[model samples]
Target: MTKLAHHLGCFLREHLPHERGASANTCDTYAYAFQLLICFAAKRMHTQPSLLEIDQVDAPLILAFLDHLENVRRCSPRTRNARLAAIKSFFRYLEYHDVSCLDQARRIQSYR
Candidate 1:
């Protein structure tokens, strides 16, 4: 584990106060989504979350993570899509911050 999860957690806890106000369940689900992605990324890199860079996380990895969520985690299709949406929202946050990823985000848009 690294600060990445902490940072994401903080983002949800502090910045997105509206999430709890609006839908705590959705916020919790999104938090799980972030946890799943970052944990998977860290595992793949064999490093901590703080060590994970935008380049190390590409579309393939993200897709693999999603597939794992479905097959391994046994998440429903609706849950998978919601998780994917959370992931896409995360990337959009990265993009907003001018983080140019090595992987094109659009290429990873597949449930299969």
Candidate 2:
């Protein structure tokens, strides 16, 4: 598996559950957020989600994804913000485990 896939698996399976003690509903919501994001990124990049790299999910793509959620998907601002929060949380998780993505994580987190 790619680094993105591996880390994502670990984040959802290990970190969110055991380490962070997130509830099942929260985990489910976060998973759904990523499901949408992975599909969006894959379609935009003309690649399969499994083939996507962590670096490809930059601030620009993230901003575009948020826009897509609000406009094309017709999601409410609350839903859009929730999805963004989920993405930001994932990047925060990456901050310590993947030092190479620290800058990218910060950029995503700082987006307002």
Candidate 3:
């Protein structure tokens, strides 16, 4: 699997639950947010979600995904912010595992 796929699997299966002690409902919500994000990034990049790389999921793509959630999906601001929070959390988890994407993660976190 690609780095994104591997890290994502670990993040959802291991970090979010065992390390962070997140509830099942919270894990499910975060998974759903990533599902949407992966699909959005895949479609935008003209590639399968499994083929996506961590570097491809940078600040610009994340910003576009947030915009898509608001305009195209018609999600409420609350939902949008929740999705953003989930993304930020995942990126925070990713910081230690993938140092190359550290800057990207920070940009996402500082998006406001």
The candidate that wins on TM-score is: 2
Runs of candidate 3 with Cα error greater than 4 angstroms are none
Best-to-worst ranking by TM-score? 2, 3, 1
User: Each candidate: what lDDT?
Assistant: 0.67, 0.93, 0.92
Instruction: Write down the worst ten-residue block by lDDT for model 3.
Output: 1-10
Clashing pairs in 1: none
lDDT of each residue in 3-94, candidate 2, tens digit only: 68889989999999899999999999999999999999999999999989999999999999999999999999999999999899999999
**Cα-based lDDT at residue 55, candidate 1:** 57
Q: List candidate 2 segments past 4 Å from native.
A: none
- Ranking of all predicted structures according to lDDT, beginning with the best and ending with the worst: 2, 3, 1
User: Candidate 2, overall lDDT?
Assistant: 0.93
lDDT at 5, model 2: 86
Q: How many clashing pairs does model 1 include?
A: 0
Better of 1 and 2 by TM-score: 2
TM-scores for all predictions: 0.71, 0.96, 0.95
lDDT of 1 by residue, 1-112 (tens): 2234444655577545653353677678788887778888889889987777655667888778878988998989888888888777655554544444314445553333
For residue 111, model 3's alpha carbon misses the true position, in angstroms, by: 1.0
